[model samples]
Target: MTVRRPAAALASLAVTALALTACGTDQQAAPGEDKIKVVASTSVWASVVQAVGGDGVEVEPIIKDPSADPHSYESSPQDAAKVTDADLVVLNGGGYDEFMTQILGSSGQGKPTVEAVEDEHEGEPAAHEEHGEPAGHDHAVNEHVWYDLPVVQQVADQVATELGELRPAEAAQFNQSADRFEQEVSGLQGRVGEIAAANQGKQVIVTEPVAHYLVEAAKLQDITPPSFVNAIEAETDPSAAAVAEVQNVVNARQIVAVIYNPQTESPVTRNVRAAAEQNRIPVVEMTETLPTDKTYVQWMDAQITALQSALSQNR
Candidate 1:
């Protein structure tokens, strides 16, 4: 995807770079500031940090707007300053939020950073290759790893470990909080398992693969044309044949539901949604970040619930 950094954003970044040079390498909290300052790429990861850190850390998400697309997000000087000042930084990584990666790279502060994708699969090969799929298609290593509950659990544990190292006095508390968060994640996983048991192999379609991992967890088959998914992710129009194939699938009601990502909606996707609605096929909404006033667990739980409801209603 093309990321256009505005001139103002570049100027802000330059100012932040200068400020960091003046401040030197000190990344500690200010006097009397007890909370560990945590900066996350989006509210999804921020919610995870908040759950594990509890009262011990003050978390800030750079992309808090629900409608904002992380792929094309423009970073400002304040965002860079946040990364420079943060004791710990959390990111989804895997090229999903290149803006955060850019800020972290430019900050040069060497703060403790936890990336959900890279850190979760530290020793494993590239996920798409491991699955024996091409890089950018249906079976690719989806960077939206937040939809993968097991990965989320691993990330939470890492967050606790990182926080423990920062404030050794509260190490045990952080671990305990992560333990509790894991239990909740386990509960969410169980729900996904239930969906799998009830509707394994059920066919569905998506505008983009934002919930690829979640759909996989439930053993649902995403019949979205690979070309269509690739084009949507690349922010380009799919070939005429690809678009026609997807429309045919929807018109025929061949899929159980249409998994739609409204955040990345386009005219083509909108037309697909309209076709699904007209055919009375369910359209389940998923997003890249947390919805308003929701914790990570709450957000995933709600999506899983919606998926189950969609399947049952179609049945």
Candidate 2:
């Protein structure tokens, strides 16, 4: 999605970034700066970097608000300044946060950058394919890759490698931290597997495809109509027929649960939720960013548990 930023705002940010550059505040650790400065596009990735960097890094996320829509996020001068001053930058590429690209492009800095979905943009196959998922899984069409646990693990390892390159003395520590984090992620994956074993082939629906990877991992079928999904993702209203079809499915309780994204709620999505509630079908919220005071793992664990509970209740 193309994120529209005011040209005047971008120009002002560019000028401010240039001024900061002229002040010799390069992308390097200054005297008495003990931690590496890492900037991420969202708090989800920021939390991952923090886990891997442990006490050796200071991570800042531009879009930390859980309610904010990352697809349409606007960039500010302060955000540009953060990217310019960051020793390393991490972003979920694949057009999810184009604002980060705009800021980085204008900075003209050659600092190292890590893109979680870099493989997708580089013409490489999707991460799901690499992990032996079914060939039919359209991971490339779903940019919300953070829902993919294996991809998250890979991003953690990449973060460790990038941090190690900056501080060789702590390279081993970073790798070890990443390993520990991956172990925890594995535990979460195990829970997902249990859900799959119990609820395989069960039908579910989503207002948006934000949790596509997670649903796929659970072996649950997403019966959301394609036209409805396309319209919602494109920020348009679904046709009356499409909306009625989804509502009918919910009213019939054909799906076990409705995976709703409250962060991107619209009248249509809310209507779907209402129909699900009226039918006593479970509605589980899946957000794009971390909730307040929750770590990435904690947030994901809660979501998985919620999904399992919803499915179990249906059973």
Candidate 3:
């Protein structure tokens, strides 16, 4: 599949690599440089590569916390330096990490970039619209496809393919990692299904669209507050009317829990959690970005359990 790059992608990287020729006379390499150096756009993507890479790779992630939004990222010269040096780069593709692309675009990061969301599953069904693009070159679709399992499976397959080729010596390890990742995806699909079918059609609310795919997978009905979703896109506080609308949704609907995106914090969440408590509804704190120590499957399983508890509350 063709990985979309800005018009200047190849030109920038080509120029930079040429400039490097003027800076240093000796060809010095990074210490322990035998491993494949891959750049993952997010912490979640980084963790998956780490899982699949094991000893064969050294994966560096650009955004590492639950508190930062990739939508409004500030890329520095240092970030460009990292991308320029990468052997392979992975991005969420539906335009989620524009900063990543921008850094690479300018720094001359000609290293092969795998579009995690769009490259792998161009035709398969996905849990969300972020899955694939039209057969042509349009890139205006939803970009947060990593929230779905099929999209993630596609991501793993693409990542492994790149790793296998870049580090042919680690081919076996990369293949094994891909196989294990695929199995984990299947297992996650089953577990998510079990949780969703158990509380099928149960009402839920979210601070962001992070868990939209899983909510779809688990069959939880989302009564997402328009204010929260909108405010998030604008990076501002919600209006009083929006807040009132959210409170009304929680109180009127038997909303089992509010799946708050840890990455996207809001005073709205705090107030809504209190409101949910007053209404005797539960709150389930969720993360779109993975923790430093979690495997992808563990993170996903915990989320399923959290959703189940929220949905089954006071039922």
For candidate 2, give the lDDT.
Answer: 0.81
Between candidates 1 and 3, the one scoring higher on lDDT is 1
**Model 2 CA lDDT for position 82:** 94
State which candidate, 1 or 2, has the greater TM-score: 2
Tens-place lDDT per residue, model 3, 123-223, is 33232344343221123344556667887786676667666555555656777888898898898898888886677887777777667777777887777
Ranking, TM-score, top scorer first: 2, 1, 3
Report the candidate with higher TM-score, 1 versus 3: 1
Error of 1 at 262 (Å): 0.4
> What's the count of clashing pairs in each model shown?
0, 0, 4
Give candidate 2's error at residue 156 in angstroms.
Answer: 0.4
Query: All candidates' lDDT scores?
Result: 0.79, 0.81, 0.68
Worst 10 residues of 3 by lDDT: 18-27
Which lDDT tens digits does candidate 1 get at residues 37-144?
899999999999999998889999999998988988999998999888887889887778888878877883355676765422233223233443433365335788
Can you tell me which runs of candidate 3 are displaced by over 4 Å? 1-33, 118-141, 225-227
Q: Give the worst 10-residue stretch by lDDT in candidate 1.
A: 1-10
Give residue 112's error in model 2 in angstroms: 0.7
